[model samples]
Target: MSLPVNIDEYSRLVVLDDNELQAQNVAVSVRERLQRLRGIYAYWLQFPSKFDKEIVDYDMKKFKVGRAQAYDDLHLTQILMGNLQQASKEFMRWKINRDLEEDLRLARQRGDLRAAASIEKNRIMNNRTDKDDEPELEFDKIVPQQFEMTDDPTVIGIQKVPGLRDRIRKLEKKYGDTKIEDADYEEIKEEHDGNGTGS
Candidate 1:
């Protein structure tokens, strides 16, 4: 018997192929094409019905199906298209989450301990209610003048002072040797001798 040109007839034709391998191959090809067509149909359904005839004509040509077959095919195609779209959206969300987790793991393994801790803290904070804790000030807000310019001579002369040997010697003697009474050499020697410690 000849295959029916309609979708219902096409299904019957699938059952009649004598070569099982050929039938399976055709079925796989048709199903794959049908999935792609469904995706297109999902997008097309977003358009107004005034373009129905245009859409139908386009599908018939695109799928190489007869007019009668195209009519029923469009409906089934639309249902599959909707499902595929949802699946695609869900897959994208899952993929994004997986990628973020991988990046976090790599950051931790690379000794970026602060970054790993921040990620974990963010995740924990995100799961809590707004009232759970007070919001902490952001780094930029806490130190608003961090990047601002200063006119202090100490700031301007910082680079120049390092190269001045005389100034460094004077500053070092004045500041570096200014020790507390508790840090006197005699007190240190007495403590060390009493403890019978050798340096």
Candidate 2:
């Protein structure tokens, strides 16, 4: 297809080419030009008589055309500026709507319809929770307890008197000194008892 000449059309072309960088650059240029055009219109509106002649002269120089041609160019530029302004407004609205929809979806997922409605209504402003507004719970409160026991001494000890060493074998297995052979024990005992004389 043939390429377009209008700024908006050219921006769409850049976007459709799948070159985001080029598209963004074109959009920035278009936005700057649109802002400049709007400013000119505002100034002309405020001081029509003072600006009209200069605007016509500038247009004539820019397009290298006659007075009628300059008028046509200015009309077309105004129309394009209006369209750009509407497009920008629509883009902003779309972004806000999309964000609200996502927030509602998340709130629904978390089972909070009130939160979803608040978000939709734009009532949920602050993200931080107030300490005073939060509910107070007795987290440190303690409850009384009773216990029963069975024939197993280990279970009985644990239930009746917690932390009692219920099994000597298990305790020894865990942290006692290493077991000594009979010969090693006798040699150690003899040295300790001072029964060993100078060799």
Candidate 3:
């Protein structure tokens, strides 16, 4: 005799996959598209008379909403901008921390005493920044991070370097751990002796 199969589970999966799941995915895609469109519209709206007929037509046709929706779009844009700013700041911080970590690992692997020390110090400072919940500059106020966009942009976040005293302290600690000769040590210190304005 053949055993009875639990056809209910199989039927549920097939039906959900074909219709409910597809509909949900489509709805999500539409929402995301609208969100992107709104952001683009808002960015252009930053300047007066920047809205061309094409943009207007796109909004009317794609969004299927009245021109009065600009008010809502503007409000949503402000919220989106604020979120984007926070996300960018967070991304920058993460990127700096990750880069320092990778640099430290590579320095150690290469036995580059001075480089390893400096990177370790930077990593420590990054950890401190995270723990301290450091305040970030306004998104637009920050200079763009120098990194390839194709790489891990989010993890390789942006950050301003710490002040001279802080950097010097870290450098001093890092230098103590290295086994460079006395002359080399002095040279390394000299090289790092810049007013702590560079990263």
Candidate 4:
């Protein structure tokens, strides 16, 4: 079966079997054009306040291209620079982090332990990205921890805990200096518990 194809589109393909030198010349011209375009792009990116006309003038003088070609190069450069990632803050941050990691790798390879440690420390200390060591926040655990909140003051100003409590004793030893009689502490504890009133 004959395939259906657009003859007009196929006619655009040229066979360059005889004109080899002309094909080579076209290839070289394209290469030079793209190189010039890339140079214009780099010049335009050097500063945010750089004017488009300045870039076009630089390209025209630098590459000896006409005003129209220089402006075309500037237009292409603007389109290339307009990419989402290239202009985003996150991309800049990621690029810096990647560069630091590469430096760290090279330092370690050369056995420069001090430089490697410094680079690694910089990567961690900078508040740029989410660190792996950061704990995943748990909503359920956000409830304030239940401690034995007491006001008797006996736990602190007592002689001995009899080890009745562990955490309370720790707090008392750390914060309290005065000590009370053990018998009186026990009586106060009973009164606070409402056991002494016998209501």
Candidate 5:
């Protein structure tokens, strides 16, 4: 589906405004346009040449760009996508910070000293100047609301730590006898190590 504005008009989004409200407005618009373009990109990937005119027309009518500008300029499209990705990351970061602040506020209000201390420490460490500006939270536990058993053989095999430990013991015995190939033994050992089954 095409956007209301031509894709070329959205070139302004490449240089977002300094004003928070203006930037948010542009980001919302750009997100919609990007979603539309993503659908077209997916379709083009599947059916290569079929939607060329449709995509071009959508870009021209909505973005106010010429045919050549709309159809051939992949670099511009990629840049817009990059901007969207950055905006999304920033938004998620902001949301996480906001949530943690809210949680800390609640903890303080409830006078939960232990929870407040841990959450405050996490917030401080997360916003520490020496480290990268990333959001981190310390949780006592993660209780999954739902769990499902996978039918996939690979997943089933990976989940079987006991079976893997037994195999590792067999591999170790073979390795001692010099009966197993070094490559095969190393590969199994790597898997065993990943499973945290042995030293």
Candidate 6:
């Protein structure tokens, strides 16, 4: 990169030459490749189980990319998709986008203005599809009918209030004890049940 630099008859060495420019171009190229791969990975995500040839073809055509690049992206996606055991709405969204993009790409490539416009319109309509189609979440649809929430201590206190005080009073009056707490074991009386559970 160190070539002759002449500035008004003054020549010196410079580290930045065509090589540096080429390096910058290389950086841009790598960045674009990564973005394309990421976009590809976002679609048809279920991997082997949900691998659709039409979907893959659509994505590749939409991306205006060769199958080699799509294959690379799919390989990487398969590795990353290992953890996704089930299909989700997110996947469906990506799948839809990929399909639309593919169709739009094909339309544009074929110079079919009408088809491209229609696809774009469909994409716009799809943006709000789930909004009217169904609830945002199953949990959001839970409309309780006279629902009541109580803490554990409050519930136990409420349930025991009616009988607890009366029982304590009866025990206190009967045994005449100050504590009125439960005994560990009842004395083995002569006419007790054989099970020993005091039943």
**Most accurate candidate by TM-score:** 4
Candidate 6 RMSD to the correct structure: 23.5
Question: Can you write out model 6's per-residue Cα lDDT over 1-199, one digit (the tens) per residue?
Answer: 1122223221111123446535655355444544554555555453534544454575578777655445544444444443242355558767888999999999999999999999988887766663565532222233434547854356555543557767978988988856867769867766558787555
By the TM-score metric, which is better: model 2 or model 6? 2
- The TM-score that candidate 3 achieves is 0.27
Best by lDDT: 4
Q: What residue pairs clash in candidate 2, if any at all?
A: none
Ranking by TM-score: 4, 5, 3, 2, 6, 1
How far off is model 3, as Cα RMSD? 37.2
Kindly report which residue stretches of model 1 are placed more than 4 angstroms away from their true locations once superposed: 1-26, 39-51, 81-199
- Model 1 lDDT vs. the true structure? 0.54
Stronger candidate by TM-score (1 vs 2): 2
Higher-scoring candidate on TM-score, 1 or 5: 5
lDDT for each of the candidates? 0.54, 0.53, 0.53, 0.60, 0.56, 0.55
* Model 2 bad stretches (over 4 Å): 1-82, 123-199
Error of 3 at 151 (Å): 66
In candidate 5, which residue pairs clash?
Answer: 5-62, 5-63, 6-62, 6-63, 6-64, 7-63, 8-63
Better of 4 and 6 by lDDT: 4
**TM-score of candidate 2 versus the correct structure, residues matched by position:** 0.26
The better-scoring model by TM-score among 1 and 3 is 3
lDDT of 4 by residue, 1-199 (tens): 1123233322232222325435655455545655675677666566545666687789989999866666655554554445232365456677878999899989989999999999977886664444565563232222333469875567788565465578878988987877765663343433344565643
Per-residue lDDT of model 1, residues 1-199, tens digit only: 1122346634444334336535556566555445435534654756534243566677677767655445545544544334444455567656765665777899888999888887666544444433466563232222222356764457656554455777877899888885657653553443455667964
Poorest lDDT segment (10 consecutive residues) of candidate 6:
5-14
Q: Candidate 5: where is the Cα deviation over 4 Å?
A: 1-82, 124-199
